[model samples]
Target: MTATAKPLPAGWTIRLHRVHNLTVLTLHDEHGTDREIGFCPLTPDGPQDLTVSALDTIAHPRLREAAQNVVTSFYDRTAAARHHRDAFDRAVPDCRVLLGHLRARLPGCRADLGTDPNELTVTLTLTATTRAAGPLHALLARWPGHTGHGGSLADGIDQDLDSSGALTAALRQDRATEFLIWYRGQC
Candidate 1:
């Protein structure tokens, strides 16, 4: 895949650039543009190609975490990515359990999980705006399953969780006020 940019929290942007044999990672914002955050030399078949960590490069803890997620998306060779993909494969069944739980407790709530064809993005759509946020927070908090974190969503999904335990990044798409499953666990 070619170089791409993904939206970050607070109107920031993370850009991944693949130039020749090196992967250039940068963070962009209105105040500062294209600040180098991380870089990895491309080695298609080598063991160290995607295993490099940016902890030493990035000083800020929060920004480092965000940058790591973006950097990890550029590679699927890591064990974490493998674990994420495995869990993603079982999203349907896991979501079904969540759906059942939601409906059982909230009888009139309208909720469903929709997975994109590429399996990179899954939408947890709560159609009832009046009662969506509150119940969702409770349900998700009590959900008896593993939760994916950091770059587990992979690809381009945002990791920003709102006060209601919903992903605010999901609001960028569809324009509907819906909560998204920010961290999904294989149950």
Candidate 2:
């Protein structure tokens, strides 16, 4: 167990330790689940030797954003340009607008942004009961990743419920998903 914590995002803490000459960045959630984001080889220059890809693997969306600022600070001209371009290329255009519209369309529901553990992609998730499914399904019909090869919503959507008893229907793309609506039964 670690003694103290660092100034990270709310409810999250970061710890760094040396392992065989490498620095491993670990994150602890509110529940104290320790997740090893990734590790980088130590050098005389310290974290400046870290690459964009290596730093990008830091989990937790807020923590990732914080790490990106520090990681990109040491990048060279070419690396910095590539990092900027890749970031722009990975973003979903007008994402806030879409989320706002989603919230408006499904009143009383909640909408949130989700990122994969690897920080490679982003998703917009709408959490609602089956009562909102009809509207959500209609919206999904027009969006990409809505239908699988068979042209059925079920095909595209993950059929199984997650541990939280919610199923997600995602419109996946290269860097972002158009939408990832989570359906849960009413309480």
Candidate 3:
């Protein structure tokens, strides 16, 4: 028999030959087993075209190039948001330790933090800080992405910051205050 051909996708082969004035094709498996795939009449002046689809070659409908895009896009976005949320969950407790550090390190300081979680996003606020050092005043400085209020500790600032942002600010200020973290059960 002829030498085995190079590797091909399953159920595909380099099989084209003239037989009875027709161009015939075949398929081979790894074991060298093969069978006629199709036969087409040759062009009078040249070889006839043999169109192949994975539908036939692989025995399944070929997927579009973007076939998984919708599912994949949803999975990717959801997974990332879930991971960020889980990370935010884990980060909250760490803020307490940072609070302890800040209170111990900063001068004559008291702190009050508030958290609000509304379905999709968690909002944090530095409701209170007192007698904090001048240098540490900007520790809670709001950046571009955060919503902040301009007021002094006497005014009872209720500035809105992301949880992670507040955590960073709390760490820098070295103050921790108690939070009544019990979530009221769904009504």
lDDT (tens digit, per residue) of candidate 1 on 50-105: 22233334443443454665545534323444554456445433555555665666
User: Tens-digit lDDT track for model 2 on 74-160?
Assistant: 233335445544553455455566567767776644566554433334444556555565565565566655566777554324433
Candidate 2 regions with alpha-carbon error over 4 angstroms: 1-91, 152-167, 171-187
lDDT, model 1, position 100: 65
Global Cα lDDT for candidate 2: 0.46
Which one wins on TM-score? 2
Off by over 4 Å in 3: 1-86, 111-113, 117-123, 127-130, 133-135, 141-187
Candidates 2 and 3, the one with greater lDDT: 2
Candidate 2 TM-score versus the reference:
0.43
**All candidates' TM-scores?**
0.27, 0.43, 0.25
Clashes of each: 1, 0, 6
Residue 64, candidate 2: how far off, in angstroms? 24
Please list the C-alpha lDDT of all candidates, in the order they appear: 0.43, 0.46, 0.36
Better of 2 and 3 by TM-score: 2
